[model samples]
Structures are given as structure tokens and as C-alpha cells.
Target: MSLLQEADRNHLINEFQALTEPVKLVMFTQEMECQYCRETRMISEEVAELSDKISVEVYDFVRDQEIVEHYNIDKIPAIAIVRGGQKPKDYGIRFYGIPSGYEFSSLIENIMMVSRGESGLSAETKAWAANLQEPVHLQVFVTPTCPYCPQAVIMAHQLAMESEFITADMVEAIEFPQLSNKYQVHGVPRTVINESTHMEGAAPEPILLGKLQEAVA
Candidate 1:
């Protein structure tokens, strides 16, 4: 069964026409695919089928420990958006759970962003990232049902694209209960900066940059 509908596939084909470079969607799953793990892989494969510029690589979370460690992947059903080639170029943009619902848009957008090698961030945000001295990890906790979640996820991902020191992840709260509880993610679109400061709701680029500034300071 196709995870994507006919109309959506057509739309994606047109959207993907803008791609100038190749993209690799490296997905991690175990033998006994965890909750939504199978669907996540299916989604990656389906999306990759839409464009010749895109490809999918599936890896076992347990069996592929070396590649898993290299990518810094610690969980199942994770998707890493990277530039495609013999040597995959990683930008540290990741989806910690299935990029379904609104977050699906985030996945697609990140693919395009990676292909173009541009962050689409404001000048100020780019400037801040250029001077960042410490590594920043952003985990945007979200639910598939949340309409506003993609904005937060996209902004964090843009930061990751802009800075080598910044890594961003979109975490589905329901899919990862322990992680959500650890961060006390009681609200959707909660952006966690450096595992410390957290902001609720879909924050704009300036606010995110300001928060990032605080995290590294």
C-alpha cells in the first residue's frame, strides 16, 4: 500500500523539481520495527520514489551500530536528512520520530533545504550562527496533530543547516514518551535548547536566535 496518495505524489513531484542536488534519507529501524518505525521507513521510501534527486537508505538500529554511531543516532525510527553521494554529507538535521501529519512538511522542506545547501534564515540568524562557539542541540518536541509544530521544527532545522555546530531534531512526543517526560513536554512545539532552556509555542527566528544565544552563553 502506498503511504502517499496520488494527488500528493503529483504535488511532490512538482515541488521536487526545484531540487538541484541529490538527497539521501537515511532511516534507522530494528528487525522488529518499533511503533511507527515501519511507517517511517515506508514514508521515506515513498517520498524518495517521488524524485530521482532523492534516495532512501534503511539501517538496523541494533545491527548497524557503526553507521548508527557515526550518524549519532540513538533511537529507532529516526530519519537523517543528508546530501546524497558515495559519502553522505550530514547537516545534523534529524527527525526523531515519524514525520507524519504537519511534521511531514518539515521533512520535505528539510530535504529541499539540504539539497540547496541553504538555511533560508534571516541575516541576523545566520550571523549569530557564524559566531557560535559551542555546540547547540535543539530538540523541538511536537505531536503529529499539532498544527503549529512545523514552524518550530523548521526554524530549528534552519539553524542546523546554517551552523555546523548546531544540530536540530524534531521529536514526536507521543512516540517518545520517556524523552517527552524528561523534558516535561506538556505543550506542543516546545523548543528545547541545549537540553536546558525551553520555549513553548511556535517561536520566530529572532526568538530562536536569542534563545540559542542564551544556551551557549
Candidate 2:
């Protein structure tokens, strides 16, 4: 069975027609004890079929230690978007779970951003991200059904796209219950910055930037 509907596939093909550069979706998954790992890889492959410029690479999380370490992937069902070229280009954009529901849109947007090599951020946010001296990790916790979660996830991803030192991940809270409990996530759109600062709900760019600033400060 196809993960995407026929209408969705046509829309995605049209969207991917704008790609001028190649985009690679690197997925990591283990064979055993990993829920949704297969589905994650399946969706990535399905999406890759839409565009000639897009490709998917599936790796075993347990066996591909070197590749996993190279990409800084620490979990199963993880994805890394890389711009294909002669030079090394990893914008540190990642998804830590199956990007279903509203999060699916984020995955498409990320592909476009990687293909264009642009963050699509405001001047203020871009300036802030460019000047960052410290590393920041953003984990946005979301459920598959939350309509507002995509905004939070996309904002953090944009920041990651703008700054090399920032790594952003969209974590599906329902898929990883232990992680959700560890972070004490009781609501959707909860963005945890550097594992300390927490912003609940869909925050705008400036507010998110302010939180990022606070995390480094």
C-alpha cells in the first residue's frame, strides 16, 4: 500500500519540479525492536519517487555506526537532509520520528529548503542565527494530530537551516513515550531548547529567537 494518496503524490511531484539541486534523505533504522522504523523508510522512499532530484538512503542504525556518528544521529527512525554537491553540506536538519499528519508538510518544506540552499527566515532571525557562538539543540515535541505543531517544528528547522551550529529535530511525542515523559511533555508544540528552556505552544520567530538567545546566554 502506498503511504501517500494519488492526489498528494501529484501535488508533491509538482512541488518537487522546482528543485534545481539534488537533495538526499538519509534514514536510519534497525530491524528489531523499533516501531515505525519501516514506515519511516517507506515514506522517505515514496517521497523520493516523486522527483528525479530527490533520493533516499536507508541505513541500519546498529550496523552503520560510522555513518550514524558522522551524521550525529542518536535515535532510530531518524532522517537527515543533505544537499548533494562536491562539498560537505548538512544543514543539521533532522526528523526524529515518522513525519505523519501535519509534520508531513514540514518534510516537504525541508526538501525545498535544502534544494534551494536557503533558510527562508526573516532577516532578524537569520542575523541572530549567523552570529551564534555556541551550539544549540532544539527538540520540538509533537503529536501526529496537532495542527499547530508544524509551525513550531518548521521554525526550529529554519533556525537550523540558517545556522550550522544549530541542530533541530521534530520529535513525535506519541511515538516515543519515554522521551515524552523524560521531557515532561504534557502538551503539543512543546519546544525544548538545549534541554533547559521550554516553550509551550506555537511560538513565532522572534519569540523562538529570544528563547534561543536565552539558552546560549
Candidate 3:
């Protein structure tokens, strides 16, 4: 059974046809004890089939220790979106669970962002990200059903793409219960910056930037 509907597949094909450059979806999964690893890999493969410029690489988290360390993958069912070529362009964009529901749109947007080598951020926000002296980590906790979660995820990803010091992750709260519990993610679209600064809802770019500034300050 295909994970994507025929209409969705056709739409993605058209959307991915605009890719100016190739994009690679790198997925890490282990064979045992992983709930959604297989589905995650399958989704990556299915999406890659939409465009000639897109490709998927699946790796075992346990066996590919070197590659795992290289990408800094710490969990199963993880995805790293990189620019495709002889060399991988790691923008530090990641999805820590199956990107179903609203997050599926986020995955597509991220692919386009990387393929164009553009973050689509405002000049002010870009400047802020470029001058960051300290590392920042953003983890956006979301459930698959949340309509507003994708906005939070995409905003963090744009910052990640703009700045080397930033790493953004979209964490499916339902899939990773322990993380949700640790972070006290009782609501949808909860964005935790640097594990300290927390934003409760889908914030606009300016507000998110303010939260980032607060995290580093």
C-alpha cells in the first residue's frame, strides 16, 4: 500500500519539478524496537520518487556508526535534509519522527528551501542568524494532527538554513513520548530553544527571532 494518495503524489511531482538543484533525504533507522522506522524510510522513498532531483538514502543507525556520527543522528526514525551532489550540504535541518499530517508540508518546504539554497528569511532575521556567536538548538514539539505545527517547524528550519550555528528539529510529540515528557510539551506547536527558552504557540518570524535572541542572551 502506498503511503501517499494518488492526488498527493501528483501534486508533489509537480511541486518537486521546480527544483533548481538536487536534494537528498538521509534517513536513519534500526531494524528492531523502532516503531516508525520502516514507515519513515518508506515515506522518504515515496517522496524521492516524485522528482528526478530528489533521492533518498536509508541507513541502519547501529551499523553505520561513522555515518551516524557524521550526521549527528541520535535517534531512530530521524531524517537529515542535505543538498545533493558529490558533497553533502548539511543545513542542520532535521525531522525526529514520521513527518505525517501537517509536518508533511514542512518536509516539502524544506526540500525546496535547500534545493534553492535560500532560506527565504527577511534581511533583518538573516542578519541576526548570521551574527550568532553561540550555538542554538531548536526543538519544536508537535503532534501529527496539529494544523499550526508546521509553521513553527518551518520557521525554525529557516533559521537553521540561514545560520551554521543553528540546528532545528521537528519532534513528533506523540512518537517520542519521553522527549515530550521531559520538555513538558502539554500543548501543540511548543518550540523549545536551547532547551531553556520556550515558546507556547506558533509564533511569527519576528517573535521567534526575539525568542532566539532571548535564548542566547
The digit string of per-residue lDDT tens for model 3 on 27-139 reads 99986738988888889999999999999998899999999999999987999999998666899999999998889999999999999999989999999998998999999
Alpha-carbon local distance difference test for all models? 0.92, 0.90, 0.92
TM-score of 1: 0.97
- 6-71 in candidate 2: lDDT tens per residue? 999999999899998899999999878388898889899999999999989899999989999999
Reference-based TM-score, model 3: 0.97
Which residue runs of candidate 2 sit more than 4 Å off their true CA positions?
none
- Candidate 2 lDDT trough over 10 residues, lowest sum: 82-91
Listed in order, each prediction's TM-score against the native is 0.97, 0.97, 0.97
Residue 15 of model 2, lDDT score: 87
Clashing pairs in 1: none
How close to the true structure is residue 64 of candidate 3, measured as C-alpha lDDT? 94
Candidate 1 residue runs with Cα over 4 Å from true position: none
**lDDT for model 1, on a 0 to 1 scale?**
0.92
